[model samples]
Target: MLRLASSFLSVPSSLPHLLALLLALLAPAASAMELGIDRLESRGFDSLKGKRVGLITNQTGVNSAGRRTREILAKAKGVNLAALFTPEHGLDGKELAGKYVANRKDPVTGVTAHSLYGPTRKPTPEMLKGLDVLIYDMQDIGVRSYTYVSTMARCMEAAGECGLEFMVLDRPNPLGGLRVEGPPVEPQWISFVGQLPVPYVHGMTCGELARMLNDRKWMSAQCKLTVVKMQGWERPMVWRDTGLPWVQTSPNIPRADSPAYYVATGIVGSLAGLETGVGGPNPFEICAGKGVNPDSFSNTIKNLGLDGVQVRPYTAGGFSGCRLVIDPKAKGDLCVLALALLVETNRASKPDLFAKSPADKLDIFWKVYGSTTIRDQLRQGTSVQKIAQAWKPGVEKFREERKPYLFY
Candidate 1:
């Protein structure tokens, strides 16, 4: 597949470079990726010395060595670590999705922890008071609706508002960087969920996104923004190649494949008003919903002969509710599966129901797909192939537009 045997060209005969590379190449599966901040010596954490900093992160902010960032920064020479700000999942990563987290003292560091996901999902002028710079170093699930991207955007805006500097310690997008899928969100439908026009699966890392956001008008002109880029990462390398650990960014994303399936089945679950199995052992693996026939729906999709994925039946109840099967192979084609599922389900269900009145449960979905094309196509009984064909030009155009921003 993506063999890199050429990595040995730089090695000297006396050195064990090839051996090391071979060992790495042969490394056991599930080894974690070494992220940007993990290479602290190269990235220069010392630049943060003497700065009264407020950090925006959650459990995924651990150092490569598994130490917490606040702990490391506090012990480092000259760092005046003052406060901590948490995102959607809260500081400890224990809070349920969308739950409010209030300000409290971190039991270990005693740093005042502020909740960015509570009443305000952004740092207010008061929140940024006395802070020299606001540093963001969280793992993003790489989806437009994941909320971490929006959190970073708000932090950048607040930095501008209060004349504070914003630094983004980037991390991989988990879904890899080969392609940016789905449609760019319409600015009018922008919410805390999504504040920009980026596609559903933006292939760039957090640092690259910060650079793009720094040029946008939504940010305060006065704020100085900087991104510490990831080393040895390229646009084509997915999370599997990163040689680092997996830390769950959100409660539902328990594994790397979760985000991959999220791009596809997640959309289907949400649009159909079904249980996405977020809280289960395999979040995206479950695709059941209320009033849905899991077997029939699964058969319909299987009969469509869609490439690169399979729909398996499943059932959920008690809080999760009813559902359908899953596409375990749905790694790179989440949006494709989303469109396919929508198109197929409509043909088997009552005709034109979605066309008469499309579901508007989450504006974020509509924003990304660009004008409800998936739902509209389904309602009109359009074939899955036709709808996918229609999205080709838009997907290609978006991939081209995001070329400059690509980072592995």
Candidate 2:
């Protein structure tokens, strides 16, 4: 327990004041954190006021009071909410992954919502015609390959080219801020999924990433950036500690803690023949294949001595394997868990897991992993421990490089 207050000294002399103080001390401390949108509202939407704003967000962009940021901005006095933009999923987040979402008029605000996942991934000059600023407020899952951050980067480039200001309403990295894992994106593997040079599980908020991209000149052009920082959020605080409600970021990421599981299994899931509970009730929560023995898989994972995660025999979608229960508080590398699963799966059932995977699937795997080297190494019988050890240098370098941009 993190207590909000420790001691109350110099008590009020009056009886009523003293009683009220006692009541205040006796009441349970609130852990409610003010998000970027909440803070912006508290400031009377000053940055957005009198500005023609283009909001890049999805269903996840809501204030502390559960009010949509788009609606708030649309109705805010003197704020003209000119346009809307959505990332991989559509504005409502009902669209499936990798599916193209067509542009449509937002029924509520009547603003034309542009699909950044469709024919045009970046904002066109016509889309930026009358906008003064592009405000991004979507929740990111803290994985480099998730693509929302990539959309943000491209929008920043467009903002720079059009001379429009860019604003990011900061949100918490659900994986917290201390954990950096896996390899940085190699130059050749850079794509929409691996846009930034950050590691797979880079632990920074959207605002921090924006600042770093602009300052580092990672994007082609730099935009005038403004980050409306959150209030009462700490680096160690994960989603559960933030006291904010979880809006499903996408179709499969249906819970607040889903990001941890995604990091644990997303890369491995990219390979064909492995079922990661995508269609079932628990998406990205299970590692199972057609011929896997559940007991052996669970026991092997347990013997690996990975922290912050517990494994058990589980069956889902006619595939038998282990269900991962990750403890966000513990200091475990989720990507390492993915490697462990890959290694164990190869040892137990799929000896040809990598060798037999389809070329397209392998392509996706390498792109998501940020390099083809890891796959090649794994195929050549590299131990999971040694592979994880290899990631230390790059992860450490990123930890130092990201120091200047971290807000919390």
Q: Give each model's clash number.
A: 18, 0
Residue 334 accuracy (lDDT) in model 2: 81
The local distance difference test score of each candidate is 0.69, 0.89
Query: In candidate 1, what are the lDDT values of residues 132-195, reduced to their tens digit?
Result: 9988889887788788888888888888878888888778777767656675566566776666
Q: What's the TM for model 2?
A: 0.92
Q: Which ten residues in a row have the lowest lDDT in candidate 2?
A: 1-10
**TM-scores for the candidates:** 0.82, 0.92
lDDT of 2 by residue, 159-230 (tens): 999999999999999988887898777899898888999999999999999999999999999999999999
lDDT of 2 at 47: 76
- Distance (Å) between predicted and true CA of 40, model 2? 1.5
Model 2 segments more than 4 A misplaced: 1-28, 316-318, 349-351
